[model samples]
Target: MATYIIGDIHGCYDELQSLLTQAQFNQNTDELWFTGDLITRGPKSLETLRFIKGLGDTAKIVLGNHDLHLLSINEGIFPNHKKDNLTPIFEAPDCNTLLTWLRFQPLMRRHPAFKFALVHAGVYPRWSLKKAEKLAKEIEVQLQSENYKQLLIDMYGGAPCSWSNNLTGIKRMRFIINAFTRMRYCLPDGSLDFKNKLSPEQTNNANLTPWYEAITLKPNRSILFGHWASLMGKVNKSNIYGLDTGCVWGNSLTMLRWEDKKYFSVPSTIK
Candidate 1:
């Protein structure tokens, strides 16, 4: 039995299927882990949602920023953008069921036996593994609770850039959500920067650093994440893996086999 972790899918369901075939994934035996952004910006948001949800016990997904935005729009907390292609999902007969399943999905997951953790984006540099787990669970509880609508309404923004023990209420939740889903570059002191999308070498800002570069994770701890497709699956570290290859942006969909560390990809059908 193998376990495969795939990068940001966006809405490229065709590429997702091709990548699965390339990996020779067995739905009966192998498991699939998704780094989220499962829908948006591409043509097949509804198909992608339905296919992944159909995987049932074989699929594990962490919510990316786009995923949250989709939820926000679905719940009427946010407006659909002009470039957005998520109308199909909203118009589907199973839209309510799909969104409910998505709302309950966690922001982070840890393999019970493996030495790695999975998140949509990088973890806070100041947060230890235990602390990260606890904090992630906090948001998961709020999202799955009856107050989730209000939580979604307050989930936007890039405020409270630095982590503070004193932060409370929606402020704290927003910070946690950003760090887990939308974060990319951060200041030296671990304050997240939502402005930069350029890669580490391409960036002109001297003070900005890739989030993984600033992480101070303990030994034996590794993370598999997506989010920043601009990195193009490059982190220059063994423990940190960036799987988002920008498939929806006309790049390839990438995946890594956790057990043997094999990589597989398929070119995007769009563009």
Candidate 2:
């Protein structure tokens, strides 16, 4: 059985279907590992959620920033952006089930057999695999709890850019979330550069580095992630695989076959 790791879907349901078809995905035997951002931006958020939900045990999805935003908006903690266009998902009959499933999804995943780590964005360069998983679980617990809405209410705002053992409460949570979801370039001192969304060289900031470039992870292990579409499907170092092909922005959708390192893609219909 093959295991395919797909990039951010971002509500491009048709493109997802096309990529699966191109990959010849087998629902019964093959497993799908989604890097997240399963909803928002594109036109078919509701359909995308339902289709993935239908996969049941065949699929593993991590939570992305967009996924968290959906939860916050649903709970009235954050105002919905005019560009989001997620009303159909909120009003869908299966909204509760889908949201429940989404809320329960973990922020980081590790597969010892494959010696790979999967996350929506990327792990902090300084964090060991075990530490990253542990920190992710801390936030995951809050997202799964009864006080989840309260946590979401305080989820925004950025500070405490560098890691601190003494950090607690919402500040700590925001740091973890940003590292796992929204991160791209960061200062050498580990302050998140939230405004630098361009390619690494285009940013004109010499002190900044992509998370993958900040440190050397184990040579034998790999990190597969999404969320930086400007990289344009670059895998960068051999140990890191970036799968965000910018489907929501009229680029392609990407998927990687983990065992064989095979790549498959489908052109976007958005434009």
Candidate 3:
């Protein structure tokens, strides 16, 4: 049973199915790990959510920023943007069920046998594996609780930019959310930059570095992440994988077969 880790799907259900066909994915045997952003910006958000949710234990996921934004929109904290392509999800009969499942998903996951740590984005440069895991759990508890709406409402923004163990309340949660979901380029001092979206080669600022470049993970600890579509799966760092191939932008959807480390991709069929 090979474990297949897919890149940012972003509602491209047809491509997702075709990639699964290309990979020979066996729902009853093979495991599927999603790098998240499962909805938004593609053609079939509802189909994507329903299909993945139906997978049950066969699927593993870490929620992306778009997934969280969908929850916020459900709670009336944010307006639905025309560009997000989330109307199909909202119009679905199982919308609440899908969103609730999404809300319960962890911000981080570690596969013991594969030695891969998964997050929608990169880990903060300042956090150790244990600290990052703890912080992720901290927010997860609040998110799953009855007060989750309040937590969601407060989790927006770029604040407390630097990590401090002393940080408390909403500021602490927000920092964890950004690092796990929205992080891309970071300043030299290990603070999140939040600005530039260019590929590393295209960026003019010499001080800015991709989050993976700024940190040295423990030996044999590989990090698998998506959400940086501009990267197009071209990170030169060892044991660090960027799987988002910009499928929502009419590029290919990429996946990694962990055991043999083979990659399979399917060109987007969406227009």
Candidate 4:
């Protein structure tokens, strides 16, 4: 059985289907893993979510920043952005059911047999895989709890860029959420930079390092991530994979087949 790890979909359902076909995906045997951002800023968020949800056990996804934003908007913590055009989601018949499933999804996932792991944006540079998984689970538990709205309320912002075992409450949750779903560049001291979204080659700042570059992970730890379309899937490191290819921004959607490391892509069909 083959496992396919795909980059941020961003609601490009047509592209997703094409990519799957290009990869020769067999829904009965091949598993589809996503790096997140399944919806938002694309032409078919509702259709994308419905198709993946209908896949049931065949599909797995981590939560992305856009996905979290959808939850916050649903809970009235924030208003819908017209640019994102998420009204179709709220108007769907199984909207609440779809959201309930979305929120329960994890922030990081490790392939059960493979040495690789997946996160939306990145793992904290200083975090070990075990530590990262523990912290990710903390937010997942909060999201699964009845007080999820409060978790969403507290999860905004980029403060507490530095990590410490002493961090607690909202500060801790924010750090974990930002690192997993919104982070880009990181400082030498392992502090996160939320402002810089440019690719490493475009950045003139010598002190700023890509999170994967700054990471001290063991050589055995491989991570696949999305959320930075400007990267266009170029991290240049063998162990760290950047899968987001700006599919929602008129670029192509990309995915990698796990067994042979073959990539498949489909150009955007949005107009």
The residue-by-residue lDDT of candidate 3 on 172-263, one tens digit each, is 88999999999998887778888778899889899898999887887888999999999999999879999999999988999999999999
TM agreement with the true structure for every prediction? 0.98, 0.97, 0.98, 0.98
Candidate 4 or 2, higher lDDT: 4
Q: Which residue pairs show backbone clashes in model 3?
A: none
Error of 3 at 99 (Å): 1.1
Give the per-residue Cα lDDT of candidate 4 at 199. Answer: 98
Candidate 3: lDDT over CA atoms? 0.91
* Highest-lDDT candidate: 4
What is the alpha-carbon RMSD of candidate 1 to the true structure?
A: 1.0
Segments of candidate 2 deviating more than 4 angstroms: none
lDDT of 1 by residue, 1-271 (tens): 9999999999899999998988888999999999989989988989999999999999999999998888889888788885879888888899899999999999999998887889998888788877888999999999999988899899888898999989999999999999999889889777989988888879989999887887876677789999888889989987999999999899899999999999999998888
| Residue range 7-33, candidate 4, lDDT tens digits | 999989999999988888999998999
lDDT for each of the candidates? 0.90, 0.90, 0.91, 0.92
lDDT of model 3 at residue 38? 96
Scanning candidate 4 in windows of ten residues, the lowest lDDT window is 212-221
